[model samples]
Target: MIQASISAVPGLIVSFLILAALVAAPTALVAKARSKPWPLRTALAVYLVGIAAVTLLPGDAGLESWQCDTGMPTRLFTSVSSLLNIALFAPGALLAVFLFRRPVTVAAAFGALSGALELAQSAGHLGRSCSVTDLAANATGALLGSSAGALWIYLRRQSPGKPLRDLAWGMSLGALAVLAVGGVFESRIDRVDIVARDDQKRALAETAVQADEWITAAARGVFGSDTQVRQTATATASVTEPDEGGCRLRITATTNHGTISGSWPAKTLESARSSDVRADEGSLGAREVAAAAARLAREWFPQHAAGSVQRVRPVGHGPTTVYRVTYRRYAHGVLMPMRLDLTLTGTGRVLGFAAETVADPVLPPVTVDEAEAKALAQGAAGAPGEFRRALLLARQVRGVWRPVWLVGDGSGGRASGRDVAVDAVTGERIAGEISGAATPTAATGGPPSSR
Candidate 1:
């Protein structure tokens, strides 16, 4: 939640300038009409605008709508950020109540404001995420703030807050109603789930053995010959019916000194499974678990799997405490482009590992280099190209994986920009574009068959 708040600052800064310009207008009118102090009104206006800025502009506007990429919050505590969100907006709602002396009017205005903000976010206006949870959090804050302000005015032997006691009930009812409607929509959204079976042996014994050997050999290369290595335990793999994303093979296994696991589902490493893997309690904390996962990943595939741990957060999400670590993958020994995610339950128990591994990218040839490709894309679009990247990969196209030089341009396919696939052999361009941000859940799209 704190991480999310910090990210909102960039957009909030922009809105603040806008808010600053209009602050005087609101302050003059409110202070004069309500017989309030100038300093107090100015301060209140500033506070409300700041709240509006944060509430409206949360984070990057990925070229996708409803980027619930963080995955749904299963537990109640997952939404403590909602509480902070409420606090941020409360002051403004309270000020509105004081100025209007009407709880109903203030609450209605907040509802409309929240709705507009949500729409703007969805439409990719200010580079912020559109969240249903945020709307609820803002509404909850506004209702409470309005009620409190009205109550304060009433206690002062005034008629301002008299309607609030009854209005509070209406506010609660309205919130529940909105949640119910949103809940219906959310429930209708499809999800990818797995059914698991514990195996005394991995899916293919020889393949698993090869993967194990890959890890051990890489471990020796990475950690030296004297490093303590782990032996693989029989893994638990799930076979789920193919969804829109295609059939995903997920498995979790514990190793001798650590753990080894992987999933072939999402482009991001953290989103392999919806459930949590429990580890032995009172054991390894966050850093230890991350180290073990990193070591295992390095050993699993030294060249491609090399990465630096980016972010680590301890979440009380499942039965056992889990450490979710994001590792930025190194491509051609350079940082960025790819990412690996590792989640370890308590005591070094590996929960899951995910990555988009272009196992064998045959770089045919490059007729169009980076600069030329950028110019080509810009000329084709007749607009300024913001981003350009060239990488060789066996892009699965038409149920076949063919080598291509993926050239990304900021043409905003999803509005975040997408990569154009250039034929490595023919030097011709493909029709589609790969998105810049990691895809959250897979949906209907003509894709090469999933491997």
Candidate 2:
């Protein structure tokens, strides 16, 4: 939730700015727009049209995850939020139409324009999506605004010619328009999310081995007139005996782009399938690794007999625990030996893992170095040198300072750092105890080191 909140701050700021403009610009366009009697009907009509326009625009406006792309049902959280927003405005729009009597044409025009603007913002090309759903919601909001205006008029019972009534109506219509516009830019209207910089390295590292294997296989395949991409890749990994940590399974996959491989060094057990083991002991169960290894071998070679796990052992520990496991792969009625170098969390969950073919197996344990540690940290931080200083500084103190990569002013470059903390490593700066100063202190910290 905290991560999500931090992620959403930029979107909120954008929304506020857009909303302000929407409210203010209309007042300038039609000076008397605020003065007229309530036009509830017109507002409602506009709201409907506006919503329709926002949803149907082309370009990459809609969310493109496997779920959304494959037409899976939306999650409950999304459905509830949409329904709530719509419910909030429905009654208001009806009342607005009943009391203000807005012209249908004006309402329709507003709706259409509003939807178009939202689409422009949502589609990445225009920094907006041509989102039909957004238009629908905005239209609903317009109706609500109109109804609110009508209620205000009915309660006031002012003379039809009074300047106050005209002002009230204008204000209501303008507010509705502003709200609709604000919601689009302010609340992350676009659902198409690309991976951010921080997570990219981790994702790449995790998938490198698979990519290599796939490329290698493709290349080895016979090329034909219809051949699209052609390649074979293979990597050897070491195995160890089972120990306290989860077994290690390292697979190095190579590809034309580059050779990338990951090792699952540790695993944490969130829940054990069997209660014979203490659930609190966070190491991955030997049986689980065996199961996964068997599944992989079977999936890889369905025509061959299933493989068996020979051994599992811990190699090291830190951000990710390291393990080495020896497993056998059976192919074409022959048993082929293989070793898995697995990287896992302390909790027994797999992180990065790989498997290598073993022949003449007497491979010695490889040395783990500071470079590897730094790389792990960098991956966790999303980029090198981003959280380095902060993490280094935090090492001095017992308390925690959160990591965040904020969008900096001016250049729009990302500035990554932690909240205020005692700088024990360099002793250059120390944070004094102060209540309610966490955010301010963090913000006032000097510019982050250039990455």
Measured by lDDT, the strongest candidate is 1
Model 1 quality (TM-score)? 0.38
**Residue 206 in candidate 2 has what lDDT?**
58
**Candidate 2 least-lDDT 10 residues:** 267-276
Model 2 Cα lDDT, one tens digit per residue, 316-408: 544334444444332222223333433333454333333433332222222322234344444544543432323221121223231112221
RMSD of each: 22.7, 24.4
Model 1 residue 447 lDDT? 23
Estimate every model's Cα lDDT from 0 to 1.
Answer: 0.53, 0.37
Question: Which candidate achieves the best TM-score against the true structure?
Answer: 1
